[model samples]
Target: MKPLCLSLLIPAVLFAGATVYNAPAGVEQDKLFQVKVAGQPSFVYSLPVGGMTYFSYTSFARRADIEITVARPVETVAIRPTSYGIRPVINGNVITFRLDRTAQISVEINGDIKHPLLLFANPPESAPPKPGPSGIHYFGAGQVHNVGRITVTSGQLVYIAGGAIVRGSIFMDQARGVHILGRGVLDGSLYKKGESRMIEVNRSSDVDIEGIIVTNSKHWTVPITASDKVTLHNVKLVSDNDWDDGVDVVGSTNVTVDQCFIRTKDDCVAVKAGVQYFTKFNAQRDVSNVVIKRSVLWNGAWGNGLEIGFETRAASIRGVRFLDNDLIHVEGPEGTFSIHNGDRAVISDVIYDNCRVEDSKGLLVDFKILKSRYSKDAERGQIRNIVFRRIRVDQAEMPSILQGFDATHQVGGVVFEDVKTGGRKWTSLADAGIKATHTENVSFK
Candidate 1:
């Protein structure tokens, strides 16, 4: 097979914070392609062909109308995984597409899987909200702000501009009323393993994080621990390393995570009552009232698409909700929706509603209250009152598993309503290919 070859050409624009890249010199100039979004030129980079059998990369634009002009004429062009239902208007080699909202999608040329374009449509940039009477730390666009480790104080605002790249990590410890807002990029590529998370909020209250793209994180992309009333909105995280979870909420209450896009190598989103980092702070308190909704999650490796607890240590975790989300790809043994309650926390009142899972290489759903090697506690947790409603899966290879450790700590009061697989309504547990072991009060509708 011939080596896949493609070139990109980005026009120079006057946008202050737009990303820019220089094409390599060896490729034919005629093979170059240009992409324009919302009248502004965006920086496009080739995604590395990793262990996967394809080539892709990350690109960003703030505009809804995207125009791509490829150098060579194409016989056929289509978007892969077809579940996204994106159709581009092909005029010769020039393609025009419109996006109503921001998304991460792949573009294939001539039915070729060897080389494809992974495009990330970012939301339009707005002026960073004023810091108000409180202090404001701002980083404008078209610049690289090297902040090794930033710690925000109470009642402060840290704003990153749309084109600016903040190379470092952000920390909020023991703070209240902190706001982190931007359309910019927080890049953790420079951070080594175990250094720090791309963003860490600990012991904070009434915090808000919005409209930021985080890339190449060495550790967890975002970890909010021991924080209450925290809200994350319209944030996008892309990671290619191990343990690079998109967003991890641990030992927190009243947390709302919405309108985000996460493509990572680990769990896209994980909710835990307590972990090693916040065990002391979450000793007696429970994690409750957390909602993750209207987000897109893609797991690269070694994790669940949406998971709750393997290291849970708190007394209880309640009122957790995952709603109106799209799990595009889950590439691990762990299922698309997983609840592995390993510790002593009583996990209850959890709901997964209106979720659309496109592809899961493993199981569709796995819920178990059992002890694992990763658990610090010897006793398993109790999982009850869990509901999966209007959940749809396009493809799943393995059967779902719902098991409890024993009768004492069994999974109970579980219901799957209006669940569908491959356009077939799953009215029974067997139809859903779910294996229930040592569980009680399981119902399907």
Candidate 2:
């Protein structure tokens, strides 16, 4: 995909407009198209090659009208998560649409997935916190701060204001009651891959991270290991490098991720037990009570959309829920709802409720308990008591796999209720593009 000329950004830099918020002043803009929101200019961020441009705004649930003029001739336009049923009107190289509520959608022009535009419409933030509080670290708007690493302790707060860009990674190790709240950007573009994770929480408790954009992570975007009672809301993750998973909850409990947008080359969100972190931190605990709901995910070529593991060395991984998440795009060799248990954990009580898949070039569902290269245990694991309810797939072209290691280590007690693929309700494994092997008690309702 050819990048548009950068000269179009010269006029955009001087515009006085009704922006949703102040953007970082020095970042490069995507000039493939000119965007206007409510008759004012809105900036679209240009990422590296093979990545897409993204524009985000806050609307407070009010109707927002957006206009985009393409730099080239337009033939067709499509908006997704098709579940939203948004149809735009295009006139001469220009596109227009209205959104009544908050959504994260992809605007694909001329059916070009390679150069699509990701539009993130956000809800209004209620009472954004300010500076000068005790134990509070605040970075102001529109400035680029070159802080490399932020080591947060217990009972601390790090607030990144909108338009502020912090070139750093945050680590909360062996801490409690830490809050990382912001609308600003946490950029890891300066670091090489494997150098840092954008935000890492190890052996922490009672943590709240919300409304921040973590982009270009050197490694995993956010990895919560051996943590408890963590909440991540309205977060946006954008990274396309290898191993740049959006969020990984390894051996964590009582974690809730709500209303976020994640686009990555690796898994959008993954759950694991006893998985080794990059450092020698806490890696000994069960994975339970992890909930990911009301989020938007775009998985690139390397990993699953919502995965359980290829690393489960703990005793069990239980009570994980995926509710009302829209997987907008998944391009992979992995499945959309996958549980790849390679270790000795007895993974159970997992459910996917009201999940929708818009476009997937891979399998729709995959549950396998087999050893892979990521396995660390001598004994294989099992997957049981899993449910998929009200899952609707719009476009999926691959067959799902349900396989177990052997007779003793199996995948059992699985049920799919009210599941639909390609606009057809399925009651059989073949109808849902599923193939089972060495499994037990799998049924559709």
Candidate 3:
């Protein structure tokens, strides 16, 4: 969108009259021509942020990857690709770029991004966190001034204190019996609009993230893949950006998310499994034994809490519970608490207990089961054994909806208990909290 300026020069000369013109000199070396969008040329910057190098090209060009390494460890550095006569690719601490032609480039080093890059606020590896008089460590130290990708490897009792800001993904891979305890913080405020992921927990087991504050992440706040026995307690996940979610647990088992505060633009908590035709990573592996309790939600720009199976086919989601949680500021212009098998998975034994609602404009719970588009299991099972008990609502405008789009997959055993009314009541199909068709054995208590 921005206009660019190209340098004017004379022809190269040799032997008074014979011409010997080579490549462009100086900034022209790094200067790339015709790298324009629409009609104007744009500039891409190859810079370092949070201990990581990024090769960013302007005008939405196909990404060029390269690596650059810093000789000395400086507190902060900003690398711009336009100045270096090249586009950069960021790999860890290294940044690599390519010059447009054989030319000279100018590089200017500046201090880090005009702010306090808090490194590590938590305790170091050598020091163990001390417990309180009650034998519980409520908080850990704070870390700042680090950038890019952060890898937290195998260790015991790794505690991160609150107020620690992380600009990249927190990679906890292959860690056994890890505990991220205390009232700490993991801040990813910088990547609030970028393409980087906030946290990635892979191949980890028996891990616990409790009593922490994680905010301003772009994608999922906490993502669990191939992990087992994971627990999230009293953690707060909040973001003001679009596509921000509380937690996304995929292909994980025996996971529990309880006593947490979630506020974002996406699902408060979403669970899923892998399918053969519709899966991304491994296939035919379903998620099980997931529980959510005592949590509070502010609002997701889309929906509040959800269980989606758009990719997973014939995937059975079982033993899931949403207990004693609060859903605040839910907008059901469509519906809230959406759980649809998407014509595939058999979502079974899901329970919602003691859920209090402050204000909602959508259905309290939505479960629509149908045949799988990708699976030949035409006899796909129903959304079975789903129950909602002791749900107290201070306000709501929409009735709960339950509908089986087709006859092959029917809804079964749906119950609503102790439903309390709140807010100014309106009457419409859009106003009922429960709307169902071909839903069987459904009851409201």
Candidate 4:
């Protein structure tokens, strides 16, 4: 697939320190679109249309009315998957829309569904401060601050103000009471893959990251490892490289990810019990009490929409919840709700409630306790007490799967209540087209 060739006609809109980006020369354009939020300009990139089964760069907006201007005469404009309930009012080439919360929307012009624009609208932040030393490391607006590999210590607050593009990554290790707050862009374009993450919280606690836009990460965008009481709110992460996950919570507890927009080339959000990279600190920890609510997850080349444990080295992982979220687009062989517990951990007490899956090229649900290539232990894990309540799939190509490793490690206590596919209620395992093997106490209500 090739990128669309277009041009930006408008100059940069500068208002109160916010600057919208103009597409540079020699860069190809797609539809020549421009996005503005609260009279401030945002940078839009021209990405390949549906290249590697994922959409292009996603633009962001605050809670105000958003205006999108495409450089073409539109015959018709519509937002897809229909579940977002966004009614865009079109006047010529400009389309106007507003969102009450965060959303991942595909804007189609003239019925060109393959080259649709990806837009994400986020809620505004309350009580944003000026660039001053209130115990905050503030980056002022309209300037490209090049700080490489910022190491945040304990009781530090890093604030990147609006319109400021900070070109670096943040590393927080063994820190406490850390806060990363702002409406700025943290670009990891200068770093190499596996060199750094956009925001890495390792062995930290009581950390808060809110109202930021992270782009062009070389590795996993935001990886929280061995952390507790971590809260990520109103954050937007967009990446176009391999292994660029939206957020990977590994061996963490009491974590909450709310109202965020994540578009990555890998898993949108993955909960794992110690992978190979962070084996030292995470090998003995379990992931528990995690909640991801009211967010948008879009996968690019590979991986699941919301996944758990392909590298299970801990003892147990439980009490995970995915509530009131949207799985907009998932490609490849993974499912919208997937659990590949390949290690010796006992995984249970997980729930997927009120999730609306728009279009998945893989399975709707996939739960398996098998030994994969990433597994270290010969003994497989047990999976039980899992529930999927009120999950609606608009389009799916494959059926669900629930399989155990062997007779010793079985899957039990799985239930699906009021699950729907293509607007039809699923009353039984056969009605939902699920393949169950070596499982017991599986019910559909």
The candidate, 1 or 4, that scores higher on TM-score is 4
lDDT of 2 by residue, 170-226 (tens): 998889999898767788988887888889999999999988878887698999999
Model 2 CA lDDT for position 337: 93
| Model 4 spans > 4 angstroms off | 1-31, 36-65, 73-76, 98-104, 110-116, 130-135
lDDT per residue as tens, model 1, 1-445: 0122444333223343233322222222222356766545444443331111101112343335667777668778776335567788999898888665466565667865334555655554454465344478887654567788888999988897655667788888899999888766687867887677888888889998987778778888888888899999888787778888888888889999998878888899999865755235543358999999988787876898999988788889999999998887787878788999989999999999999887688878889887787688776789999999998887633489999988798989999899888878877777778898889998988
Candidate 1 Cα errors over 4 Å, as ranges? 1-33, 38-40, 46-63, 70-84, 91-93, 102-134, 278-284, 396-398
- The RMSD (Cα, Å) of candidate 2 is 3.3
**Which regions in candidate 3 have their CA more than 4 angstroms from the true location?**
1-143, 192-194, 275-280, 306-311, 332-334, 370-381, 423-433
TM-scores for every candidate against the unseen true structure:
0.84, 0.92, 0.62, 0.86
Clashes of 2: 0
Cα deviation at 282, candidate 4, in Å, is 4.2
By TM-score, who's the top model here?
2
Q: Candidate 1 has what TM-score?
A: 0.84
Which prediction has the highest lDDT against the true structure?
Answer: 2
Instruction: Residues 378-437, candidate 3: write the lDDT tens digits.
Output: 445557888767766765444566778677577887766665566333332334446678
| Local lDDT at 287 for model 1 | 90
Q: Number of clashes in every candidate structure? A: 4, 0, 50, 1
Candidate with more favorable, higher lDDT: 3 or 4: 4
For candidate 4, write residues 2-73 as lDDT tens digits. 223444444344443223444323333344687775555555555543211111112343244567788889
